[model samples]
Target chain A: MSGASTSTAVIDPYAPFSQGKTIQLSSASPFLPRYLASTLPPHTSPSHVYNTRLRGKLLILDNPLRESRSAQLKQERAAKREAEKQRRVQGVMGRREAKRLGVWELRKEDAKWALFLPIHHLWLGYIAELLQLPPPPSDDILHSTDPSKHRLPSVPGTQAKLVKADLHGSILSVKRAKNADLVGRGGIVVHETENTFKVVTAKDELKVLPKRNSVFTLRVPVYAVRPGTGEEDGGPMWEFELYGNQVCFRSSERASRKFKFKETIEL
Target chain B: MFIDLNVPFPEPIVYESQFTPSKKKQKQKPAGLTNAHASTSAMAVVPAHPLERLRVPDRKALRERVEMLIHLGYTIIAFTQSVQSKLDPAAPVNWFDGGEGTVFRDLDPRFNGGKRGVVQLRRLNVVLDEASEKGFGFNAQTTQLLAGYDILSLTPLTTSTFQSACLQHSLPSSSTIHLITAPLLPSPRLPYYMKHTLVRTALKNGARFEICYAGVFGDGARNWWANAREVVRAAAGGRRDGHEGVIFSGGAGRVEHLRAPGDVMNLGTTLGLPHETCHAAISRIPKSLIIRAETRRTYRAILSEPKLVFSAVPAGAAEDGGEQREDGKGVKGLMEILNEEEERSRKRVLEADDAGEGQEGDGEESEPSGRKRRKRRRKNR
Candidate 1:
């Protein structure tokens, strides 16, 4: 007993005084576990100490009570969460912007190529390029939107493949005359006849005034000037590569004998 | 957790008084012509812009124009043999901008029977094949063949009360559609939905597709493959057998799988000509096949090159095969000659009548009358 007392004194110098105080105090005196020291209030008085001690014991001693409290809190939180979810569901339920499905709704890609109107000309062409539509008429000579007259891009001897090369910055000149033979020379032949024929020349287009019914000739194909004017007066010109350097001729009856120079200037 | 029912709650409604009919005297009934005139006035307001108004061009006039356009080296409607329109007789069907318009009811002689309030519509369908002894005869040499050729269909929901009972009937697929705006050059500007719709119609109505297929590499090889399995797989037996041949043989196997380059090349060669000529024909394309050999090239080839596959008659010949011999005298039998002469005389008289009416009515206005002489024939039958 003496040895134990000496060890207790070495471990805790206040153990003997603490034991004596517990025996001397009534039921109101504080008695808390070591774990509750950090959680409890710092008041160290004898009065109300038992209430603090009871609270500490209640928190530590019973597992069922703690479980019931936690479960009740979880239930309340779950109810609140479900209410919010229901409100969100009603918010988006009646929406006008939502897509209305049909028996056959067109896909975005399919809708792009539906028609050829002025508004969709450029965009439609891009879509056509993406879809890769086939060229019309598989045999014989090829035609444009107009299907009657078959077009030979170049003379038969010169089997050159023509394509659209350049449009802007290309110089085009227009000429009106009584005779078809005039304003055409070299490989160029008078393909057609009308009151006017606009000679679409290369970058080196020249300006020449006809000398009193004297026939002047050019070395390029001349086309009748269409009404629509662009940056270049020739309208949209396609590049033609000759299969061979063959000269071709076209015959046309003169419509207007009298020729007055209009806008036959450089453009 | 709560699952929301999202049921809509009803609000309160207030009672309202009933509307009482007025006890005013009835107005006098208008004359038939006045009523017609009033309806015409209303219809005129419907399409204010002249260009936006649907013009029912005379079939003959349109055909002539198409022919002229074709001759001029422009690509017009190539697949169609003819086009006509069914519309309300009361509505002013103006095919042109000004007067002397080719109205549908006024032109077609049979339509004169009972057309009143029906708004006739212009519809265009094409004849892709003709019936032959060997079965349906298609343009074999033409590489760019238009598949899924079907009667253009339309459904009219409403019309004025003045239309005749026959006119109020459901829209007919025979002549309710038309090529209002034809394709430009090299290619036709048709929407993908339109193409899809056309394909669906064809598939549902015993039509086959002439697919422009290309094959690409699967194992990252340099060779390209053809993806014509859709065409072959969707076809009947795919062989040149009898009617039972329509059942595709490759359906049992995985047809969508990427085809070998050699097989595609062989199929292209087997299909008469290379795909380069026609929009739908198979053509060999040298493309990098490493990533996706089957998807590099554009697969939609709808347009076709025009060819002289059939004609009403040889350009210079009559009903008889007279052009075979180089002799100046006609080779036709006596009866054939007599018939030809009679036909020529009849044609001349008709031509004279046409010339006389040229000022009052353009040649296009008379085309609807021509349909009375011919009858529509079903191809499958």
Candidate 2:
């Protein structure tokens, strides 16, 4: 509470009404509208400044404070934030594990990889906004006959997709691997570690694929419908092969890593 | 699409006489610098000095020439380096280090997000003489040495070299050589007769003949005219087979010699090449040649279009996202038919259940009949 509002708590013995009158009629109270005493005929509203009826009863109005208003608001905003923080789901790591998804079977009571569809949908929305991917071509634009208007955005080239773009939530399959068993197993990348990717495969089994002499085929939607739409999809996915040898850093580290063009023969 | 595939990287110092160097160390330093970068990059093995080995090209002059070519709207430009004899796989040097980012650092014009930047290519032109006839180093061991270059061409001075260039060294996937260029400057005539069989075979194998416009602007203009005209007639003028294997390039040794792409196409007219054909010579013909050369990275030299196979779409109700519409209108029509069939089959099944209500409910008999109906539906689909 400000000093002005707090002053109301103390009672003046001689003139209780004068104390209230001072709060509304002092120089600081110019923020409120002023009434003309000369225009009043008799005694409808009480006399504000003179207090002609009761003499020898003087009161002082409190001063207006600039800092206290903002201070009070700051305290309320922080309290609101603390309340919001309490609602976040807690996990083994910490509170933010609210973002972490449970096993696919536990999610929908089905062991099928399809159970993690909601998480996948959330990931698509996350990646689409993160990459600033352009909106999908509308039905009208797709059916348009004019070739000149067919403008596919040129930003999502192979270099941008492979070099440093985050691959945490993208769908990836092993195109080739040193261990022949990992030749074709692919799924949504649930957890990305330093040198291995913890993938949730279509069979709903988690596969820890090492980043050795392995080549991963990544399919990014050319135009993906943002999540929450009636039918969310990766409308037209463009396939790119990422040599595992090139990307071996952790997900956070890869964001700042620089990749140079190596000799084609070496691959 | 406009490309000058033969911009020669000239030596910095060209002595008054063809022969002597001031000292051998000057030549050796550049060669070592080249090999260090080349071994890492995919470029052919460049020998210490080739036929034009007397002078090292001017770096400033080459940079200025390429800048001028980019301003002239040449989106793709290959810095041409010629070798005297066959490359030794044992001690290979890569002289193409300066054509790309390192030398042309900050060279890109900062508009359109640099998407229209020049595609700097490294081309090795082997000036095939009698010594190279012994061996052009087209062996399996030379893949590393030869793979360094993007476009490989042969300047055949003899009939035997010409025949080998067309027949043997034309595998774009395995072997590096695809372009066949001859010295069409100041010669009394071509060193060998232009055989029809040799020209057709070379064209069929995707080998293009280049006529350097830089040669025409010099003192050899007269000889260039006759030679260029003969090459064009031999390559594209004969029958209506759509054989346009001849390409025009700027073999500019100095900055002043380079010309714009449109002006070069116009000059090709003086050599009896039609306007449209000459336009393709600089644009579409070389574009396909350079793109096909990427097949060198593929196994068994197989180059084909790739099709996208979407991960399987599972049971419809269980899917999160909508299923893919595989081509546009045709798939929609197929989907409509499937929807109508499902409705009709569902109505028939309901009617069958109603009719069986009066009869004794035999679970086994009904199950077989239902399985048979589903089987027939699958066959119809």
Q: Per-residue CA lDDT of candidate 2, range A1-267, in tens?
A: 455556444444565344434444555544222333433333445355345544355456877545788898999999977766765444233434544643322343343466555666666676666556677677665445454554544532434534566665566676556575675676767777788876667767677788767766655554556545824542445445566765677888887865443212112
lDDT minimum window of 10 residues, candidate 1 chain A:
A159-168
| TM-scores of all predicted structures | 0.15, 0.45
B-chain TM-score of model 1: 0.19
- Native-referenced DockQ of model 2: 0.02
lDDT, candidate 1, B1-381, per-residue tens = 000001011111111110122111012222442344333443343333222332233334433432332233221111122212232122212222221111233322123332221111121222211111121112222111112221122211112210111121112121222111111111222111223333333333322232222122233112212223322332322333311111110000122432333343455444333322221211101000000111111111000111221222211112112222213432222122222334565679999887878765666655655554432322221
Q: Name model 1 segments beyond 4 Å from true.
A: A1-267, B1-206, B210-229, B236-381
Best by lDDT: 2
Tens digit of lDDT per residue, candidate 2, span B1-381? 587888886643222122234244236446654444434432333333332222334655666787788888886777777777776444544565433322343443222223435656678888888988877776778776677777788998988988888777774446757689978995958888778888887787678888898887768888888888888888877665745879999888888888888898899877776777889889878876775565454332211112232333421121222223322322122112222334465679899888877574676678888999988965873
Q: Relative to the true structure, how large is the alpha-carbon lDDT of every model? A: 0.25, 0.62
